[model samples]
Target: MIKYIEKLVKKLKTSEKGQGMVEYALIIAFVAAIAIVALNNGLGQAVKDAFTGASNMVTSASNAAGTWATHKDT
Candidate 1:
């Protein structure tokens, strides 16, 4: 049993599968960290503000279009 455990440990240490998985996990963790920092530091607010501005513009344009449609040029 000990020999089998040691063999398994050695195999795991020499395996590329585990290395690849660890590399991918590290990459995911790094990207997640970056995203968290970006969203926490005004990036989130900026995005929200942009969306709000766009919505306001669309609302204004729609109201104007409705008014123009109702008040056709004679």
Candidate 2:
């Protein structure tokens, strides 16, 4: 049993297989953080443009309705 325990301890001390996996995890976390920040900055402008386009369409429709109502008596 003593020899078995010694072999287990030696195996634990010589392990290096997990070091590369930790490095890859850190790099992927950094890239995801950068992408989130970039998306946050651009999202506001995209929403603003969509609202502006909708407002323009509503105004044009309102004007056309008013013109038809005023000229209908002729």
Worst 10 residues of 1 by lDDT: 12-21
Query: lDDT (CA) for every model shown?
Result: 0.95, 0.91
User: Please, what are the lDDT tens digits per residue for candidate 1 over residues 20-49?
Assistant: 788999999999999999999999999999
> How far is 71's C-alpha from truth in model 1 (Å)?
1.0
Please, what is the TM-score per model?
Answer: 0.77, 0.45
Q: Model 2: residues >4 Å from true position, as ranges? A: 1-39
- Cα deviation of 15 in candidate 2 (Å)? 39
Top candidate, metric TM-score: 1
